[model samples]
Target chain A: MLKYNFKYEWLLLIRNRWIQVLTILLFILFGFAAYNGTQKVKMRTSNLTSAINELQIKEREILSQLDSLEAGHELNISRWMMPTNPVVTGNLLPRVVNMPPKSTAFISTGQSDLFAHYVQPIVTGEDSTMNFKEMTSPTQLLFGSFDLTFVIVYLLPLLIIAFSFNILASERERGSLKLLASQPINIRVWVLQKLGLRFFWLVMVIIITLSLVFIIFDFDIKTNWMSFITLLSIIIAYTLFWFVLAFATNIWIRSSAKNAITLIGFWILFVLLSPTLINQISNTLYPIPSRTLMLNEMRSIKSEAIKKQDEILDNFLRNHPEYATNDSKQARGFYQKYMATQQLIQDELKPLLSEFESQINNQHKLVNASSWFSPALIVQNSLNQIAGTSTGDYQNFKRQSIIFSKEWRNFFKPMLFKGEKFKKSDYKNLPEFRYRYASVNTYSKTFWLIIISSLILFLVLTPNKHQIELIS
Target chain B: MILTNNLTKSYGGLTALDALNLEVKEGEIYCLLGANGAGKTTTINLLLGFLKPTSGRAFINKLDVVEHSKLTKQYLAYIPENLMLYPSLNAIENLDYFSGIANKSFNKKTLQSILTEAGLQESAFYKPVSKYSKGMRQKVGVAIALAKDAKVLLLDEPTSGLDPKASFEFGKLLQKLRQKGVATLMATHDLFRAKEVATTIGIMKDGQLKQQWHVDDISLSDLEKNYLETMSYNTIEL
Candidate 1:
């Protein structure tokens, strides 16, 4: 029976020239998206690699100049190696760590474009303002690219609906339904066979397209196998959801035109309207703090901490008795240093930074939890997490930047306090920024739950046999 | 065989088929004559299990039409007035689709022969039904019924748009099916054709079957006059 249905379905689908054209167009689109994604990833990787090499050469040249000037007892040439010099600081090459696109990254570019590729800490009091200049734009961040995930989640379902909405309704309208129903099997079996055939075709298309993408990109297969499978399963379940919707609509609607209209309405609601509305509602519910407010608060903390610099250093000495001394001149020398002021400012502003980060995380959590009502948002979030390109990545990056800032402060504070000259080897020992990619295991639960819920919805909403007969 | 025991159907507050009882036996040609909106089409729809009964029961070949819908459908075929087909497919393709769906396997040659047997023109066999005339489309409908080999056939205005020659030819096909013991239930307005072919004639009015006559008992002219008077519609003034 399945073979019979499959043969007939294949013939019918191929017979409709429009459906054939649509299938070809979808294949072309998928190929175009995958190619575009691969090229973008390659371009970024090349640029970052060359930039890191050039920066390393400059760093070595500056270090050599500093060493020669130090030997000659010349302060002007040695001063070029100071942390205050932007060229020296920029050439330090803060680890140059990048999250390269995985095999499935082509599937969903996600938030990779919105965030920065590198982060470095300076002697400034503001940690939030320390990211690369290239990552600060808001316009490109809002209007995203047309990635593979967008094609699967947004366009695929529409195509599925167009293919399946008239499956049974058209038969009835053409007066063949009654003739078909006068067969050996029941209506349930017949409809199930029809749906099963279409599902088989849809799955074939998904597998074919994804396989082509994998083969063409030659991406890392070892670590990405699970993510790839998860994406494919999600695609299947998502397409099935639309198929069930179209099937149910076919049963309820009397005319082919009515079925088309009703199914398109459903697509628009779930795919387009729901996500937009939910995003608006979430923003209205929990608005993020303005940058102006954050900056002003940081400024207030900096001023207060700078005013109490002597007191803060005294407190630090008391806490660490090993560093304490009864020699009044040495202690007075440490208290009068400029580095002591920077340390005092950082110590005071740590709590403020923590509070700000927590508030932003809380906002993210609200959005994540609110995604239950909109599958589009859930899919988007899941894709971003898989690609390691979400707002969460930016948050992690911010935390890393703060840690780098602390390391920078610690490295210079002792030198200034003890009145020692910074040696050339100290430059090599300076801390570098490193970003850890979030593991897929962290989000496996949410992903599976969404897939299960989508399947349940597809099953629960499919029209029953008796209802189909009556309506048809 | 088909049977309805006080079958009733209502749309909102208006009754379409009001406690009507009917039975059609094997090898019997039962023609129901009625004016527009007189419950004839509603009765056929109920027997086909398209609409549920408001009250009472309907059965096809002793199987309850509602409970054994699939079983009942297997024993019946329906031909609507318009005989719509998939406009994209030719006659042979349409026949193949419907026959395959009905689980009736037939080769291309056999299907073409069946279309010819149904009196469809050989030239139109491979042409899309969209280009076929009303009579040719009806011939395809008959061909579908023939392919199904249904035990009972239900038709609505089966001869409405056919020419005299085509109507006579369709009557001959009905007679042939009746001779083979296939029960036929038809709702039609053609009184002359009904008198010529129907073995049992019934007149329905206001959702009720008001009169019935066996062809053996009533004269042709008498049956026609009585049918017009019972339906309360005059074909000829004065």
Candidate 2:
């Protein structure tokens, strides 16, 4: 029966132009989305490459000057502007710290469009001053990029509803269902076979279109085959979830229009409403302090710290007597006092910073704990994880790069305070930035949840074998 | 091949079939005659296991219909008043699909032959049923019944919309199936056709069988008079 149903349904769908129309639609959607994603990736790569190349050009000139200085040549540059000085070198020769796109980054724009891919971390800049968000239009953020995840998580279910919503209802409406019920078979099995055939065809079309899109966009499938498979699994599982809903609605609802309305209602509830509600609740429950208020607090604290700079420096020298040399000139230098004052300011702002961190962490915890209410959020977040552009991914990058920035600053602090000359070999020991993705097994969770939900819906709608009546 | 044992069906104090005891054996055409709401269609639905009996049982091929609904359906073929099929499917394709649904696979040649035997014109064999007339669709339904080789056939107003000639032709098809040892229970208002085809006839009114007779004992006009008298008598009793 399944085989016959497959053969006939394929013929019917093709004759009805459903297959041709959906294939074209999916191809256009995937093609456009892949193009957009690759464009974003291209821009980031271009920015990083240009930054690195320009830095190389500057480095060559600086190295020539350093060689001249090492040969006992005197230059007219100012004290602070000279590259031979360790403070000058640390402040001027900052490396381009960047987060490169992952192998499957083209699958989803996710939070990538919202954040900057690269930052120049200088010794003088504070972690609080590291802005990771790029300057993007609010309208663009409101209407997010068209990506493969958007197509799968939002639009594919609608297509499934359009395809399968009328399967049973149309039979009953056309008066063929009575004839169908007379056959020596369970009605639910009949419905299951019909829906299964449609699912099979739609999955095939999606896989083909997505593969073509990937090939056209140069997705590097040979290197990221596992991620590609995961992407396909997520898509198939999500498609089944919608197909199961269509099956349930077909049996439970009596009218084709009603079935469409009910399935569409489910789609909107799960895809659009639930995530917004969750986000609203999370924000309301764990409210973070306003950035404006935080800025005011930082300003007042810095003002207070500047007034007490001399006091904090004296206290610091008294505690670390090793730095209190016989020549008080070195002890009373501007940076020595400034470095001590900066340390005091950072220490004083610790509680305020920790407050923000704890609150934001609580919000993320809320989103994670309640994401199961909507399968859309679950699949979207997982796809974002595959692309390495989720909010968590950017947060991890921001945290690591901040730590490296502090380390880079601290490495130059000792040289600056001692008024020591920066040598050519010292550049080799400067800290470099490396980004490590957050190790998360998010794929299996979404897959299992969606698969289990679909099976449960099937079992629930079909009931025991041969129980459905021929006529209502 | 068909039996109803004191079968009763009611919905919320309104009885649709009341303690109806009846039987139609091999090669017997039991035509049930009734006005509207006479439990004729109700009885057919009950025998098909479409509605569970309230107080008794319906059996097909000696198997309790409720207990072995799908198994009993293996030997049964049903055609409603409309004989609705997939409109997009041609007559031969419709026969093939329904027969396949019954787990009886036939080649295209055999299906076309069965369609031709059922009196459908060869020219219309491949035309979609959406373009078919009511009588033409009924012929395709008969083709499906023939293709399935069903032993029991249930028809509800099976010839209601046919012309006189088509109605006479359908009577002949029923006679042919009867000759093939198929048991038939047809519910209709066509007294003349009933007297022509039925071996035994029953008259029902207000969910109860009012009369039973062998058609050999009555004429066509006499049966119509008897049907009118029984319904009027039922109204008087009500």
Candidate 3:
């Protein structure tokens, strides 16, 4: 029975041009999304390359100046502007702390568009100065980029609803369902086989379309094979979720238009409404402290720290007397006082900073725990994680970048404190930054959840028990 | 092949079909005659197991329909007022699909022969059913029933909208099936065709079977007069 239904459904879909239309539509959607994703990634790469090239040019010129000055041949350079000073080198020639795109980064825009990929963290800059958020236009963020994640998590279910919403209702509407019911095959089983065949075909089309999109977008499929598989699995699962909803609506609702409207209502509820509602509830429950108020507190702390810089430096030296006693010169400079004051201010603002961090952490925890309520959130979060562009991924990057920034500062701190020179050899020992993504393997959970939801809906619409209601 | 013992169905206070006793044996065509709101369709629906009997039972081949809806359907075929076939599928495809669901798989040649036997045009065999006339679609339904080789047939107003020629052709098909000893129950409004084709006729009004007769015992005009009298008496009672 399943084989016959599959064969005829294939024939019908082909003859009616539904398959052709879907193929073309899917290709166009995937192609356009991939194009947008690759364009964004390309811009990021181009910008990083340009910045590195410009920095290298400056480095070469600075190295030549240091060499010439060391050889006693710097006639035109000013004394204070010299790179020979360790503080000068630390403040002026900051290395680029960058989070390069991961292998599957192009699969989803995720939080990529909202955050900067690279930052230049100089010794004078505070940890908070390494802002992760980019200077993108608010309008752009509001509308969002049309990437594959958006397509899979948001638009794909709508496409499935359009494909399968009226599967059984159309049969009944066309007056064939009664005829179908009279056959020896159970109607629900028949409907299941019908939808299952559609799910199979849709999965096939997706695998082909996504593979083509990956190839066209120049994604490294061989290296990111697991992520690719995970992506397809999530997509298939999410697609199954929508098809199950359509199945339920098809049997529970009597008319084709009514089935469509009901399925679409579910779509809006699951895909569109739930995410925003969850986020709103999370925010309302665990509110992020006001950034404006925090900024004002930061200004006041900085002001107070500057006024008490001498006293803070004295106290820092009193605590660590080695630097004071070991230096025979017994000298102090701008960095000595500034570093001490910076530490004091950071210590004062730690609680304020962690308040916001904790709230954000709580919000993330909320999203993670409640994402099961909506498959869209689950799939979207999974895709973002796969792409290595989720909010958590960026937060990890920022956290690591702050740690690296402190390490870089500490590398230069001793030289500055000892009032020593920065040699040409020191450039090789400068701290560098590397970004690592936090991987979460939630695909299995998401895939199984969607499949289970489909099965539950299937069992709920069992043939004999509810088919009478369907007829009525 | 079909039986109902005090079969009844109701929706709250409104009864769709009252207590009814009916039997249709092999080679017998039981034609149910009625007006718009009569229990003719209710009886067929009950026999098809599409609706449960409120207080009694329906059976096919001596198997209880409600308890064994799918099992009893093994030997049954049904055609509704509108013979709905998949519009996107051709006559042969629709026939093969419907018959295939009944566990009767047929190849192209066999399906085409069946459709042709049911009086579908050879030219229209491969055309989509959406383009076919109502009468042509009914032929495909008949072909499905033929392909299924069903022992009992249930039809609800199958001749309602068919033209005279199509109606005559449909009566001929029923006669052919009856000759093969297939039990048939059809709900219809066509008194003339019902008298001509059915082995026995039952007239229903307001969910009650008001009259029953063997077709040989009555003429077409007599059946019509009996139907009108039954309707007029219901109005008088009202």
Candidate 4:
């Protein structure tokens, strides 16, 4: 019976031109999404490269000035701004701490659109007060880019619903159901076979069209083949979830238009309403502190610390006598007082900043736990993780850059307090930033999706109370 | 063989089929004549096991229909008023599919042969059924019964909309099935077609069988007069 159903369904779909129309539609959707995603990645890479090259040029000029100063040559510069001064050299050049794009970065924009990929961290800047978010236009932020993730998470299920919604209802509407019921076969099994064949054909179309789009958009498939295969696995699983919903609606609903409306309602619930509702609940549960209030507190701490700079310096020298100069001149400069005041302000503001971090972390945990309620959220997070552009990735970048900023500041602290001269050898010892992407486990997500879809299919096929009600 | 004993069906206060009893043996066609709302369709639905009987039994080939609904369907074939086939499929494809569902597999040549034997032209066998007339579609329905080699055939108003030549051809096809010893029961409003094809005939009105007869014992004019008199409609000679 299944063999006959498969053969006839294939013939009908082909002869009716459904397959041809579906293939063309998929090609257009995938091609446009890939083009948008790849263009965004290209622009990010270009900006990061230019920042690094610009910093390298400045470093070379600083090195030449240091070489001239060491040869006892009188350079055309003021005494305070001399190359021999460690404070002057540290304030002159800063390192470009950056996070480069990952191999699968073109798969999704994710949080990449919200944050800057690189920052030039100077010795005197405060790590807690640094801005990592980009200055994007409000309109761009309101309506995000139409990338591949958006297409898969939002549009694919509507196509599946349109394809399989009328598999059984059309038979009854055409006056052939009585004839079909007279045969020695179960109606449920027949509907299953028909819908299963449609799902198989749709999967084939998706794989072929996605691969073609990647090739046309010049995606590096050879190097990112593992990510590509994982992507296809997630897509197949998500597709199965929607097909199972279609099967249930086809069995339970009695008319073609009613079946379509019911499936579309499911689509809206699972793909749109559930995720937004979960996010809203998570936020209400674990509220994040206001950035404006935190900034205001930080400003007050800095002004108070500046008024008491001398007393703060004296206390700092008493605690760390190693930074106290033994030279008889005991020459104190602006940096000597400024570094102490900055440290005092940072110490005062630590707990407020820690509370802010804790709240944001709690929000993330709440969102992750609640994401299980919606498959769209699960698949969206998986795609973002695969692309290495998730919110967690950006947070990790911010954390690492802050640690590197402190290290750069500490590297110059010893020379600034001890009042030592800057040397060419110290240039090579400056700190650099190296980003590490967080590891992801998408196989488990795909497995859970398949299991859920199978469970729904099983329940729909079984003869239960709901099945009886639907049939009657 | 097809048999029913005191079959009854009712909805609350209205009895659609009231204690109906009938039988069709091998090589016999029983024509059930009735008007609209006369329990003709209700009896057929009860026989098909599509509805539960209020009180009584129906059997096909000695198997109780309600107890072995799927099993009894193996020995019977049904054709509704307007038999529908897949519009996108040709006659041979539709035949192969319907036969395949009955656990019957046939080669293309064999399917074509069965269709031709059922009175469908060879040229129309490969054309899409969407372009076929009502008579051509009914011929395909007959071809399906032939392929299944059914022991019983149940039809509802199969000749209601056909022209004179098509109706005559359909009557001839029923005579051919009768020669094959297929017990057939058909519900219709045409007295002339029934008299020409049925071995025995019964007329029903208001959920009761008014009369029964062997086709040879009654003339066409007498059957028409009896039908009109039983229906309580005043008649005038032309």
For every prediction, compared with the true complex, DockQ reads 0.39, 0.61, 0.76, 0.64
Instruction: Give candidate 3 regions above 4 Å deviation.
Output: A325-329, A451-455, A458-464, B233-238
For candidate 4, the per-residue lDDT at A51 reads 81
TM-score of each: 0.86, 0.95, 0.95, 0.95
Interface RMSD (C-alpha) of each candidate?
A: 2.9, 1.3, 1.0, 2.0
lDDT string for model 2 (A315-360, tens) is 8777766555556554566667777887787888889988988898
lDDT of 4: 0.88
Chain B structural similarity (TM-score) per candidate: 0.95, 0.96, 0.96, 0.98
RMSD of 3: 2.8
Over A1-472, each residue of candidate 1 has an lDDT whose tens digit, in order, gives: 4555666667677776744666676778787777767776776677677768876887787677667756764555455465334324533534454445555666666766756666545443345566533453476466666777778778887787777778777777667666555554555456657876787777886787677767767855566678877667666656666776766666566677888899889878888898778667666766666768878987887678777767776766665455444567546453333345555665666776667666667667877776666666666777766666667766676667667776775665555445455567677787666567666542553555446556754564455446425434
Least accurate stretch of 10 residues (summed lDDT) in model 2 chain A? A462-471
Question: Tens digit of lDDT per residue, candidate 4, span A1-472?
Answer: 9889889988999999999999999999888888888889999999998887887787788789889988877789887677567767766777777888887788898989889998877667788867798878789778887889988999899899999999878888888887888777777888888989999999999999999998888778898888999999999999999999999998888899999999989988998899889888878987888989999999999998999888888888878888978876555678888998888898899999999889888888887787777889889999999998988888999999998888888888898899888899988787767888888789988998999999999999887633223323
Candidate order, lDDT descending = 4, 2, 3, 1
Please list all clashing residue pairs in model 1, or write none if there are none: none
| C-alpha local distance difference test of each model | 0.72, 0.85, 0.85, 0.88
Model 3 over residues B1-238: C-alpha lDDT tens digits? 9999999999999999999999999999999998998998889888888898899898899999989988998899999999888888888888888887788888889888888788888999988889998889888888988999999999899998999999999999999889889999999988989988999999998899989999999988778778889888432332
* Model 2 clashing-pair count: 0
Candidate of highest lDDT: 4
Which segments of model 4 are wrong by more than 4 Å?
A77-92, A328-331, A465-472
For model 3, what is the error of residue A250's alpha carbon versus the real structure, in angstroms, after optimal superposition? Answer: 1.7
What candidate 2 gets wrong by more than 4 Å, as runs, is A317-329, A458-470, B233-238
